[model samples]
Target chain A: MPDRANDPTDALRRVDLVLRVHDHQIVGPEGELLGNVDDVELAEVDGRWLVTGLMVGPAALSQRLPGKLGTWTHAVWSRLHPDREPTPVVVPMEHVTDIGSAVALDEWAARRLARTLGLELWLREFVVSRIPGAKGGSSDERPGDLVESASSEATEAAEGGSESEAALRPRPDGRPVSGLLGRTGLSPDGERLGRLRDLWALGGPRDGHPEPLRVTHLEFTSHRLGAELGYSADDRQGPALVRAFFRWLHRNDRVVPISALTGIDDTGRTVTVETTHMRHPFDQ
Target chain B: MKKFFAIALGILTAIGGFVDIGDLVTNGLVGARFGLSLGWVVVLGVVGICVFAEMSGRVAAVSGRGTFDLIRERLGPRVGLTNLVASMAVTLLTFTAEIGGIALALQLATNVNPYLWIPVVGAAVWIVLWRVKFSVVENVFGLAGLALIVFAVALWQLGPDWSDLWRQASRPLVPHDESHTTYFYYAVALFGAAMTPYEVFFFSSGGVEEHWTAKDLGVMRANVFVGFPLGGILSFAIAGSAAVVFQSQGIQVDTLGQIGLPVGMAMGQLGLALVLLGFFAATFGAACETGLSVGYSISQYLGWQWGKYVEPLRAARFHTVLLLSTIVGVGTLLTTVDPIMLTEYSVVFSAVALPLTYFPILVVANDRTYMGRHANGRLANTLGTFYLVVVGVAAVAAIPLMIITRAGQ
Candidate 1:
């Protein structure tokens, strides 16, 4: 990449760093990457126009001007960079490969750019790789989140159910849902369990189990599990642990308990909802 | 017909829900100080957020990516990291204020000291974050926040001469009571309030959470295009009332109780109760949004496990951050710093961070590779470019203005 060490005084200069595949925006300087920038990496690597780091800054500008002048650049940038972690807003020149709206970069910027690569490589191998059931793929491999992170749908369903709680019904939301209202239950994580699914009343007297209940578990979409949901008789946590040995392995299905679900209440509350404790309903 | 009514209701609820700690504190302070002279700023801000939020929502729907998810694809790690850090700070500040605001609202209604309620309110927020369904928190709180319509009711009740109110709103200039320095400061504050970072964070993130695919783009756009401006209307209502009632009285709105005075004056007890309900819901809602934004950015950036969809123990780190931020916000309020003041600093600081986050968004949105056929259209690019300039100027001058006006003292 063009090693244009940005001068302290010359403010309008653009410096090139290498782009990695996994770059995304965060809420601030400290958060994780929010998304990736599909862009051209134009930098002079060695002597050729081997594109370097991709350009990602304010929609206002291509790259933020560096150093003090750039300091007066944006409120968010200033706050994130406030005299604390002044990690230069730069990636090295080695990681990038192509250029366009979506520029592909080397999988690991740390691997190519580090002057002291041996140590980082070793630690990545020894410490980082072996951090107790760590997913050891290059950061680029898992860049895109497959599903929604938060579920406003589930929250709204709960709220609506609560509002109509007086109607002793089954689950409020549609779909096959078991009632977890009045019965006490254990959490998947052993914490005090809350409500699970409120089956709604299809058409009955103002009474209990006569109503159909729709289940809306805690926000446990496939996205949360970071894997696909598939439960088999032989498929146990033991195999799941072994499956995790492969960095790319992800079992989408998570285990939810049948009993932890409290009885369905006419009030539309799904009590004894457990998120973390593990019991195999299939096994049960 | 019922579903349509619900959608319309959803849209209305979104309007009220859009104004959070950022809007409440920023607009209130500006109205008291700058009067209706800066009404234009809120308009501009509403338009700006609509443009971006629509793009983000569309992107989320079509691409199945959250706002931060898109940011990652468009910006590389280094620059993306920069965006993450900047966005998180602003979100956290707003989060702090939102929690504090919730406490303040409770205090207002109960007449109990706000400090005593801070911990309880904080815990309640955390509990909701922990177990409550995401939609329940959003739709319910969003609908409940419409209680703020009492501000408009109060304005009507105050019976500010329409001609006078119209003239004041129309003649957009620095008022005689405030110096130009303070005038610009409050103007920027008003703009900052309108475009406060958390709103976008919440909007885009909400898009992803709702499983919006490109097919849902129209719905997303409708929400963004319609939701935010309407929210801006609520903000203006509050500020205009203050401009009418408090300006003549020389009463600057430094307290939550006083912010509701217009409602009290116009609609008496019912209005006051509704306004307080609005306050509780808005602040409480915003606290949840801001708190989630913090976690969303952190997890999305690192490619770590994240999201409420996961069991708390499953996404340990993400939950840890969420839990930690709630504690910090409560702790920050416990220091006895004014919630209003915290919100003020948060808005001003968010203004400073605006360019950093929005700039990359504009660039990425315009790019063809990631967005492909979905790249920004001419209208988007033009508006995006214009806002970039506006944001650039604001970013450059925010600090100097803050220092000059002493945070609009």
Candidate 2:
């Protein structure tokens, strides 16, 4: 990979992963929706958290839900899958070309990825395709349209790259961003700070491609409600009453750089960071 | 000249498509019982809908995202799921009521039992949704629903004391016989009827389907400012005619035929025919809208490709939802529930679900990240904030008022 650390502008481009990326719709190059970014995969590399891939399907989405609902959804998803034990589908970060109102996959990746939607495939083949008027509309992307055009070279490159990258790392399984949220954060002296609310990542170009966003900071707050409602962001959103209310609610929120982190104990569900490194999120 | 005609067509269709089964039933029921005393509520509801519909349409045009997509993005999964369930339930309820309304209108025209017509109506609606182009479905029924102008004509022909009606409307109060609770309950119902959430869902989704860009904003604003208020006048005419004919006779509007009787009394057979046609078009048009809304909300929330612009096979999940919602609507109507009652409750529950639907639109419309230079202006923001409070109040008061007034017994 190109030396992204040398690029001064890379550190200035920040995106709040949970707020801006997770749960966004994934669109094909032709504007056809493939699915949503149900969850995101993060790998800890060289003591830095990096977003590796975007997860899709009900199995991935179920983990984001709370309480018995999450468990129930996972159970239902597992029961419906054709595999005896199915892993959630992950689209590698390299395939993602843009993130805006929707997460857009590159043309080749979109075609290959669209084929993996199990329900869409089954419903199209068994139910919709049999209907008399199903094929009559103006849309150019019909069933099997993209699948036939998916070149073998693109597929092999994507799969091979992911596998070789995994082998080279020889690390533990990539952790889900959802799994990291809500874990307690502590100061180096073991004083409780707050719960981890969101991860801030820096996005930039490296090696002629958009780099996997590197997690640069961790947001911690006494509560998750204000952040989840998107009040933590600095933009002045409307209906002045609601904006004021949520802004007041999230006043205590703080952010600290990943470099300030001393240790992360996943099993114990806590991260130890130096309090001196913490700063107000909106100060930037 | 072509541009002018296109704008005129959009405005006319917006007027015609505005009054649905909820509007028909609520306006008729309120007019007969409460007279023009509750007219201000319709005015409020119309302006409120105009503010939010324009916002949603603009957002869709600029961002190319439907209302539910923003709801999910802004609210996150757990809260977004709750919003999805609530909004879907209300839209589905409205869908069921609209299908029932079609059957009721057909029953008036053919003298057949609505029970016999429910299944047939459901099938016809499904076939249209399945086969017809989105614009054709929107335009045909929308223009045809203009037949409802008979209510305005009938109102004029009835020659009621305009001054007297204006007196009641201008000096809003609880009529001597009506309790304050019942009067307010109908006010909320009328508001709900005027600004049902499905209208925004359908409007924004329709924006995406038609590929609206910043250029279409002028035409869209014309539709809202000119068309919807004119449609609100049609609602007033419905009430005015009902007040002239039915209120004097102490006839509470309980059936679709009764709602049309005022037209028959004023303009004879031709008016009755026109009114029935209007009822058919409005209900059928709204049934299509609400049905598509149900599919649109769920598909948009889950990020499934959804639109009539696409081949049915490409957006299989969305089409499947449309099919299943149709079946469920038919099933609900088949339970022998009174369609008028269904329309009433649907409107009230629509009142209950309003804030959840409108809140996200307001938030997203103001966000510069999505809208860039097109973000909400001061005027839009002021109106949006005011209406959010109004919607919140109505939502909070709706169910309690329903219980207290025994659903406006």
Q: Which candidate's DockQ is highest?
A: 2
Q: Write the per-residue lDDT of candidate 2 for residues B105-129, one digit (tens) a residue.
A: 9998999999999999999999999
Off by over 4 Å in 1: A1-284, B1-6
Error of 2 at B387 (Å): 0.9
DockQ of each: 0.04, 0.40
Q: Encode model 2's per-residue lDDT on A130-194: one tens digit a residue.
A: 77766733456664553333323234434545442232121256888888788899997788878
Clashing pairs in 2: none
For model 1, residues B165-274, the per-residue Cα lDDT tens digits are 67777887677778888887777777777777766667777776666665666656767778777888899898888888878778878888888888898888888889
TM-score of each: 0.62, 0.93
Model 2 / residue B238 / CA error / Å: 0.8
TM-score, predicted candidate 2 vs. hidden true structure: 0.93
State the lDDT of candidate 1 residue by residue for A105-218, as single tens digits. Answer: 344432222211122223334343333333322344331111111123223323544322212121222211112212333343545432221121112111111221112122
Show where candidate 2 strays beyond 4 Å: A1-12, A136-172, A204-209
